[model samples]
Target: MGQFIISVGREYGSGGHYIASILAERFNVPMYDRNMLDQLAERNGIDAENLYKHEEMKRQGLHRTVRGHSSSVQDSIAQLQFNFIREKAESGESFVVVGRCAENVLRDNPALISIFVRGEEDAKVERISRLYKLNRIEAKAKMFRHDKKRKAYHNYYSKMKWGDSRGYDFCVNSSLMGVEATAEALYSMLSTYLKSKEQ
Candidate 1:
């Protein structure tokens, strides 16, 4: 299998995580998602759960931006996490990294292939409601709120605008293609892409 670095940026309920899992299985590469937080916390002496909580708090405007925070704890995690992601690439390992601004972290690496996954609002809300057992209204709110948080996080952390199709090598709309189809398409495309690069 070709060694390729794939980073996926996605909106909530877009099946981004599922797509990444499929890719990792197909590529036989390590895939990282929330586990990156576990690694960051373990390495830096922070509680693992708090990493997610802190991010949520910041997203809700309960805390200032990482750079503006008085103690800058958020900033520290960002740096450590960025380093963690980079180190994985530096390890000469093929990987599918999802979220956490991984696209920005590895943007300069020639091996990097960034993908963005998006879906229609109704489709996303439907999936969120079904999977999470939330009511229609609750699911809608949760869905939109998540998008807002993601945009805030990406805008603050990366050069590319969150969910901008132009920034990624591939953009998939699961609303049209479905999760499995999107994953299959990505695998086929990435295989061809890696092969072309080797020629």
Candidate 2:
């Protein structure tokens, strides 16, 4: 059997992590998320907390010096994490990687399947609110801010937009389909894709 990879890009409250975890369980594969950051930090000789601090959110435009300093550190950490992703993918372990620009990092690998997960705004807001124990308005605002940061981070390092459908082999709407249904559909899709490639 050949190795497979799934990359999930999702909105802040879209339950992307949950869906990815489900798929990983069903497929009997490892899953990487923030834990990968800790591993990367250890390998790269950087502080894990500092790396996490720069993982999301963009620097404010004010204060040129501050922006430059933060960007440099963030870029270095991103590059190191990218290297770690490459190493993992090459290690013959089939897995699902959540965020950290894994799709962009593994774009050229023939053995990987890239997926993007998104949902309707209302569903996303409700999910975020319930999950984070925030009011609906606060959840909406937080979601917007998180998406903005994700867009900026992705655009800064990749040629493609973060959630753009064209960049992925599969684009799933978890709002309409739900997590279990989405995972089933993705499993079927992966089976077909792998079959076609083998022929």
Candidate 3:
């Protein structure tokens, strides 16, 4: 069987993780997300929490302050994580990897499909508020900040912009279609694509 890698880029509180998990279940494949940090920590002899800290960008005002520093620790951890992602992709196991620039990391691999999941701002705010138990206003502010960091992180490490349709095979709006429906749609699309590749 041909291996497949599905990379999901999502806006916070869009139920992106839920969608990825359901897709992995439907395909009987592994799902990699924050678990990737654990693997990287084990492989590099670093604390997993430390890896998480650098995985996303620092707050907005702090960016300028950290621009010029040569932080070998973060760089080494990122490289190790990239290597681990590549190794997993080449392992012949179909998997869904959320974030971590998996699309860029595995760009050279022809078997990969990159997807971006987004939702309307109001819907995202509602979901975030319920999921995180925050007020609507707080959730909205948090979502905005989170997306900014995610965009900066992706742009800083990869050539593609986060949530940019041009960078992905599919760009889905989960607000219009619920997470379950979105997962099913992606599965159908991916199955068809893989079958054609085999032909």
RMSD of candidate 1 to the truth, in angstroms, is: 2.7
The runs of at least 3 residues in candidate 1 whose Cα sits more than 4 Å from the true structure, single-residue gaps closed, are: 56-70
- Best model per TM-score: 1
Clashes of 3: 0
**TM-score to true structure, per model:** 0.90, 0.88, 0.89
Overall local distance difference test of candidate 2 = 0.82
Q: What's the C-alpha lDDT at position 42 in model 3?
A: 86
Task: For candidate 2, report its TM-score.
Answer: 0.88
Model 3 segments beyond 4 Å from truth? 58-70
Clashing pairs in 2: none
Better of 1 and 2 by TM-score: 1
Better model by TM-score, 1 or 3?
A: 1
Candidate 3 CA-lDDT value: 0.83
Candidate 1, clashing residue pairs?
none
For all predictions, the C-alpha RMSD in Å is: 2.7, 3.2, 3.4
Between candidates 2 and 3, which one is better according to lDDT? 3
TM-score of structure candidate 3: 0.89
Model 3, poorest ten-residue lDDT window? 56-65
Candidate 2 residue-wise lDDT, 1-199, digit = tens: 5888888888777788888898888788989988887888787787889878887544445433454444466666667777878999999888999887888899998787888889999999998898899999999999999988888888777778889898888888888987678778877877787778778
